[model samples]
Target: MTSNSDTPASGFLPPRWFIRAAWKTHKALYRWSGGRFGLRTPRPDRYGLAYLTTVGRRSGVDRSVMIGYFEDGDGIVTMAMNGWGAPEPAWWLNLQAQPEATLDLAGGTTVPVVGRRAEGEERDRLWERWRELDDGLDGYAARRPTETAVVVLDPRTD
Candidate 1:
């Protein structure tokens, strides 16, 4: 069986365990700090972190996670890459089951949003935007067996 280390991009990324631990720690800090840290606005050449809450597909409970995103016009865009692992992120799955969700931005602002996958030219465009942010974006993405989803979060009108 092939391991992550076998992937060409593995050299540029930290171990999967370390990546997962960092995520957990980031979330814990966000929660413990009362939203004071762990999230920020996206800059021109970098992605920002945000907190997203989606309903569990099966349990119907709210599940929250920290995601990297960037502002696109008035909407937000993120990827469904699970630490560059093979499985889809649970938050992405939940968004698929229920597109309506909420995003907690930095500065304690919350916005209701609807999630969807980008496609065709839209996907290409957004993916390019991400590429400009991280030089190793494609490398990390290639580590996965499948294409990482480009998720767009638009403000909910209703």
Candidate 2:
């Protein structure tokens, strides 16, 4: 846990309550507007937001979340930061249990996708791309114990 003016002195993630509140707000607004607001669409500045639906590992039900993503080749790349940082996101775990999922892009298109983790050099490359977008990438990552999983969702061929 490194500390500096640019990073949190305690090397902790932003308050969990704050992140949870923000998540609820984002989800609510995103749904209320049919994805017009709250991390939706390809902004000129940010990459974009998508609603990801996956099969719950235990419940056998559909679970959805709004996540930030960038295009990678023909696939969509995202990070499993979980906002709070330390604990892994349940969405990522669900995807691990079942990679086949659907991604709704800005309330426009819903596409079937198969999720896989980008590893080694590929992971490094993708992480760098995120770093380019967000300067605090490394610091946010440091708040978490485990290495952040870089996930790529490729369109399902069949």
Candidate 3:
């Protein structure tokens, strides 16, 4: 996907078929698990997968996306863009505008976190670690020349 300003708003909307398949898969799992168990399931392909919900910076509507996350010292970091081949995801842009957001984990815990963009060697190291966990990230990084970043989401203490 292209990384132009307008694309962030419209770029990541996957094909209709993909969305339907995702929804169907989610629904079937939820039904089979009786709702309670499904929410606790880990995303198969991503490491530390979690459901993140953030409000749109411009639209003011809540948006949610499932993403890969990793623990960085005391904070939680996400790849921000895995397969998108874009500069960044729309949700990440929203968090850039409004740092505070919510994350739902596999264990059913919901917590607020503050997002910050990682850079330089710190970002390189984190990306390397991510690659160690999932190799496909290397390919994802190659597709988009725009620098992929790590978003460190600090847990809200209060």
TM-score of each: 0.93, 0.88, 0.72
In model 3, state the lDDT of residue 71.
77
- Model 3: colliding residue pairs: none
Residue-wise C-alpha lDDT for candidate 1, range 56-109, written one tens digit per residue = 999999999999999998889999998989999999999999999999999889
Poorly placed runs, candidate 2 (over 4 Å) = 1-13, 43-45
Candidate with best TM-score: 1
Give the deviation of candidate 2 from the true structure as CA RMSD: 2.6
> Which parts of model 1 have CA positions greater than 4 angstroms off?
1-11
Residue by residue across 64-154, what tens digits does model 2's lDDT show? 9988899987899999989946888999999999999999886578889999999999999999888777767777787788999999999
User: Which residue pairs in model 2 clash with each other?
Assistant: none
TM-score of 2: 0.88
In order, candidate lDDTs are 0.92, 0.84, 0.70
Best candidate, lDDT-wise? 1
Which is superior by TM-score, 1 or 2? 1
